[model samples]
Target: MLKEKVALITGSTSGIGLATAHVLAQQGINLVLHGLVSATEGQALANDFIAQYGINAIFDDADLQDVASIERLITKAISTMGSVDILVNNAGIQHTQSAESFPLEKWNAIIAINLSAAFHAIQFALPAMKRQGWGRIINVASVHGLVGSVNKSAYCAAKHGLVGLTKVLALECAEQGITVNAICPGWVDTPLINDQISAIAKQQDSSFEQAKYQLVTAKQPLPEMMAPAQIGEFILFLCSDSAKSITGAALPMDGAWTAQ
Candidate 1:
């Protein structure tokens, strides 16, 4: 369904971003991969996509914390790939600490990358999408966007901001053949959670299996982590013609995390 379309996914080197890239490539979409990785590593991923899917793939190294870097990366991708019909703002960072003790610099950094970067990407990509009269902006938000958690002040704040941005942008583009939405995923089995899991195990003096189950099932009724590929598939569905009418929605794949 995505044949001849071009997609730009930030943080595409691994985890959700990489899985999304692979899923989109399978649909014959050209790819613009972004991440903080060695140039050679990025190129290698690009080559693999090209070889496996016969779709054009390029890589750009971008620092989400820097607006200038994001602008340059989007410009380069547009110049090379012709135009970006799909943009997935998947780049983010997390820090767990009490609000009172959270470093100001760390808070700024998390907000910059998680919240501000999505705004920057949309601002840069919107013009081209407007010209084409068709586009999709998928923001990879989290369940934290809809609910609160202790020791995650910055992360939750940024995600909540992203959710708000998604709604506004979706409304603005509602009649313009462009759709904007945020995917609020619960706990996903990604590298980002690996550290937290290990820490939980140490803190609780529990086995890895026990820790993993507790970490997600404590707040989420579901005991399994949502797979990255499952999220990618949902994105593919959203990009389809059937989803043209769906906009301004903070759809959750949270395994009933917010249902409570």
Candidate 2:
């Protein structure tokens, strides 16, 4: 369905973003992948995609925390890919700490990358999408966007801001053929969460599997982590014509975390 379309996914070198890129490519969407990986690694990933899918693919090393860098990256993507029809703002960072003791720099960096960068990407991508008269903006938010989490002040705040941004942008673009929405996912088994799981294992003196189970089932009734590929599939669905009417929605794939 995405044949001839171009998608720009940020922080796509690993985890959810990478999975989403793969899914999009499978649907024949050309990709503009962004991440903080070394240039060599980024090129290698791009080459792998080109070889596997035979779809046009390129990678840009974007520092999501830097607005100028993001702008440059978006410009470069547009220049190389011609135009972006689907934009997935999936770049973000997580820090767990008490709000009172939260490092100000860390808070600022999280907000800039997780929240502000989305705004910047939309701002830059919208004109081209408007010219094309159709577009999709997908924000990879977290369950924290719909609820709260302990010791995750920065993450919660940034995701909440992203959710709000999605709503407002969706409303603004409703008259146009553009849709804006957020995917609020629960605990996903990604490399990013590996550190947290390892820390938990050490703290409890349990095996990695035990710690993973404890974390996954803490507040969620689910016994497993949601796969990044699942989230990618949902995104693919959203980019379809059937989801054209679905806008300004914060759809949760939280394993019922927000259900209780």
| Residue 28 in model 1: lDDT | 96
lDDT of 1 by residue, 124-190 (tens): 9999999999999999999999999999999999999999999999999998889998999998899
lDDT for each candidate structure: 0.93, 0.93
Residues 1-260, candidate 2, lDDT per residue (tens digit)? 57979999998999999999999999889999888889999989999999999999999998887778888988898899999999999998988899999999999999999999999999989998998899999999989998998899999999999999999999999988999999999989888789889999999999999999999999788889988999999999999999999999999998889999
lDDT of 2 at 73: 84
lDDT, residue 150, candidate 2? 85
Q: Clash totals for all models, in order?
A: 0, 0
Q: What's the CA RMSD for each of the models?
A: 1.0, 1.1
Model 2 backbone overlap count = 0
Question: Cα lDDT for residue 168, model 2?
Answer: 99
Model 1: lDDT of residue 169: 99
Q: Show the colliding residue pairs in model 1.
A: none
